[model samples]
Target: MIVSIKADIFNNDKNSSDLSDLMHFFKKGRHRMNLRKIDDFSAFENSQWKQTLSRSDIDFLKEGMTIVDKKEIIVSESPSDSEFRIKEAYCYLQQPLSIVVENYEYEPVFINCIFRNFGNELITAKDRHWLKFENGGGASDNTIKGMIKELFNDTVFTKSKEKYLRCYIIKDSDREYCTINQDDTISIKKLPEAKFRFLKDMQIPYHILYKREKENYMPDSVYNNFLQTANKNDKKKEFSRIYLEFNAHQKDFFDIEKGFSHKGRLKNRKSLQADVQTLFEKLKDGKDLNDRQYTLIGSGLPFPNLKSDFSEKFNAVNRNDLEKRIEHQPLLRSEVNPADQNERNEFEHIINEIKYLL
Candidate 1:
């Protein structure tokens, strides 16, 4: 299997034009260097500069250079494991070089700086999993400091330029993926085989599944935030931001691991109904809430047609109206399973809990 890997290069802590020109120069040589090598070279270069250039100007030059080190990374290419490395360097030379070019100065302004490899793994190819990359074999960015840390290392200098870096993924056609439809509905593709089974086994309430083919690309800023909102305890090192939609009688379904892994009790209905009551109280207290919050709390509740008296009495408003009322009054919906007595009993227990809390 051959999986396409996409990536981008980001340079921070310097001006765009300066960084671009420097990158052009670096590209002229197919070079690789480790952190210590770059640092040693830089130290030697700085010693030479100390004897030749003014201290203030050298400090300014140091401010202009961005440094990086090389590393090796391993990846799976499907049925086989592969490794790659990235060599990068950080340098601090501008004025001295500019002066040297003018012929009056024998001083070298720019230094080759620090270079290292940032590691990235090729997890899969053509939808098939393969062996994991062994450590210390290739150059790459595997750590947070190398991966995206530079972009945030300096706020005033690098934040806006982040737009230059592009991130891409090659997904297989068979699995479900998230898409924003033109009509503003978040849609999903063909869901994973286990997600459906888990939903059924757990009695998750989803009323429909539709093939979503809409294209409404969201800006990276918004999308990036959404990706960052995953559960804190989740081992995010292995997961990317991938979501799919499933229509239960409720609106707005979003969960990725549920599709990938067997999430048996993650969406247990009784707990969800309790969440609905909690959301309502928050609204009653005049809190500002979003559609997702409402949907999350509501998804756990029993809908309008349960024969249970508690459900019939509490489910007074429809979904749309409930959303409107979320400003001041949140509706109560129970997660009721008409066919499963165990589910019904658990739901009743939740209802009693809600009543006691009220």
Candidate 2:
């Protein structure tokens, strides 16, 4: 799939030009030529019959592109996560590249790395060993890829080519080896365009060449689709179910108008208030306040506990206050209490008033 763009130079059709000029052109500009083929979409955009091959048979069109200019790399560490930037991308011809990176403690750690190729001299590390270096990542592709991910929260891509291939097997994390694939050592050339493309795809605008850059954050159209989920949720709604139980048998009869003793009533009300307060206090203490609801002839405080539409809205005390303030309240609902009869209406109304005291 990745072939030279100049293959059409060998097309032997009648409409093609002579081959001599093609050879001369190659000789003159071979080193500077960019080997990208026509993109699929652009190739299909032309007329069906007028064909793209130049009138010359032996000659071909040279793609207009620039070989990336080399730049000096400023390799340094930063104080915080936001400051680190990816400064290099190394390509490997072999399946796995062994890397020894310095950890945060300055200790060297090793990992095996593989990558995903994004055509036109760019690739991103696909998988890496679990162990990592601390300073950022261990030296090698791990550190570079980690820095890139930290900066853009996206994958990193860098330039590479066949001629840049390394001809050796690394025997250790230090890059030591006895097997040699190439007899000569070659210097690496940094490709800024590849870095540019990577950053651009990561949703970063403005230039990275300067500090204190000003740019607005624009979410991709794909990210915009997330709001579709918001309509299904309502923050103002309370839980529809109530975890409640009340016992008419346990009701305290307080006849204050007849000058009757209210000590028993006060004691019962205080115990109930204490229990309710404990629930709220537990929540404030970051503890769960999940208590079972009892019904009918239960001995404990016989009051209905309101359950919210969601567990996270577990402010039972506040919800009770709001419900009591409302003029219209839902009718009492109890599994054991007969829904077919309103015999317990006066009792339920008195018990529900406990919300006003809490």
Candidate 3:
């Protein structure tokens, strides 16, 4: 985080002692402290705090901070004033810097769209989202295409080049099913080419979901929990029953919102069936079926394909329950299949990339 130290600390001995402690803390290399080239230096020069510092401490302070002409500055106040002053400031350091284009500040993350309930829950989960940053480093759900178009605007793009806006993008791959190769590596049969191209050309870091969408990552526990509290309606009960019975592979790729059959979306059904059939055939000859294959076998032929029985009203209610469950338990790495060594840890990979931006 870029921080600006107030020279007013020189007026008080206690504030000066606090400032000294902060300077020592910065030397541990946890954050970057920057001072405005002219204004901040001039203030420091006129302040009496320097008189309290020895020659080595003065030199260390100078060496520790960087001088920049223009940068977002976190104004450092007296630590004694707030119990969590240091912690709060450190939290800000863990967020991506705001993109300042022509004096306008913008968020660093762009996503296709946020789920009305689930999206907010995932982004705002205390353990997942940055407390100091807006919506976890300010995610903009203007759609990937929309954000790319905005970035391509001549004036905005050209002006932004000087400041170099660092951004990360998260988009649903919308993959029907991922192919598990002979080597156990997973690959998407198809990707949204145009959107990927745009993001790649602009040099933005991005993560495309391995599954169909965020809802696919919800664990079985969430569905079961929802079932227990759900209204005693036949459709609701049926949906829960079918969902609970789904194999891990089916659960991972299933469209939670639309269910197995929505309209004539044959693509989802075909892909899922083909993937499962291939796996079933490959592992059936083995002495014992793996957990994945066992689940596949349990699903049975024709795959109990059903259109979502949820009414629009109940759908909203179910989604809210999803959000609540995820907020409480958080998405586990296992839920996204961290066992795929080729992919490694998908959740951690996304997190590490975001942390890099921060």
Candidate 4:
């Protein structure tokens, strides 16, 4: 199928990067917050590295059972006859790609979209949907939660909450609407402490503005107190205390960015520039990204097809590059531009490469 390709599909004037850089980049606070929540050995085990307990060890793994924990429940993985190997267990999570586009030929042809992966990050490999195809299609939160239930075989929730009230409704392909039975618009001023709590919980590394640009922002007094209790370090680390409003919009944006940030350190601007250069190179090279890598692109940025661009630009002749070359277009809202001349040059190089090959 020769799907119509256009320059506007991928072009963006607004600055946007992959979810890796935007969502989860500054999580010095999350690490600290997670540390405080480490009450048991299981808590100490990072969720990323948790061992898959044998099916028999947990009673919930029996075929077709829902494992309940507090208000949450674990439903088994969608029953499938597909392959399941220790090395490739995540290959089974594929469902038809559900996508939606506003207008194939028009201004804002590509709008912003969101994709929620069930905790099992590798599941998207099976198939993908074009956002333009569905009226309001995006990633399915219900599907993801169902997958999560199957993966964990047990749901974890706070003891106080009853009946799984925090369910998220899977809206179209990119947007997952939260159904927390609360007001639609959550404000920053209402939850003054949430911002500080979020920063402390995420442990993000960032520069802040204190006293209206008078001094570099440091952690607020509340954050300092939390750190004192959480860090337990006899010697203090360098603290940049600052007070800033982390309202709902900032929280939502940053939360997604934090989740999508690159795991490695981009210490300085020079280092960041180098990293960005390499990032474009990888995208142009059509690399087969694992779940984390793909998630970095989807969750971090405005473009869904960014990774596909890499695959198309790099592995055009390779048969496995089907998704990357053609099927990888995503419902993107904006495009990220390089901030400096050097960055722009690198970006333009990739764009030219796309023009030549794609």
Candidate 4 residues lying further than 4 Å off, grouped into runs, are: 1-139, 142-222, 227-261, 267-358
Model 1 misplaced stretches (Cα beyond 4 Å): 1-20, 23-39, 43-57, 64-166, 169-249, 254-358
- When 1 and 3 are scored with lDDT, the better candidate is 3
lDDT of 3 by residue, 50-155 (tens): 7777887778767857633222334444443221233343333444332211111211121211223324432442233332232322233344334445543443
Off by over 4 Å in 2: 1-219, 232-358
lDDT of 4 by residue, 1-358 (tens): 0011112211222212321121121121110111111232233132222233333322221221121111111111222233122112211111122222222222011111111111111123112221112331222223333433544332232221212211111111121111122463322212234323422333321111111111111113323443455354422211111112222222122222222344632223233333232332222234433433433333332223433331122211222221122221222211111222332221122222211111
lDDT of each: 0.25, 0.23, 0.44, 0.22
Error of 1 at 135 (Å): 35
Instruction: Kindly state the number of residue pairs that clash in model 1.
Output: 34
Models ranked on lDDT: 3, 1, 2, 4
lDDT agreement of model 3 with the native: 0.44
What is the overall TM-score of model 4 with all chains considered together? Answer: 0.16
**Whose TM-score is higher: candidate 1's or candidate 2's?**
1
Give the lowest summed-lDDT range of ten residues in model 3. Answer: 99-108
lDDT of 2 at 290: 36
Could you give me the TM-score of model 2 versus the true structure? 0.14
- How much lDDT does candidate 1 score? 0.25
Clashes of each: 34, 13, 0, 58
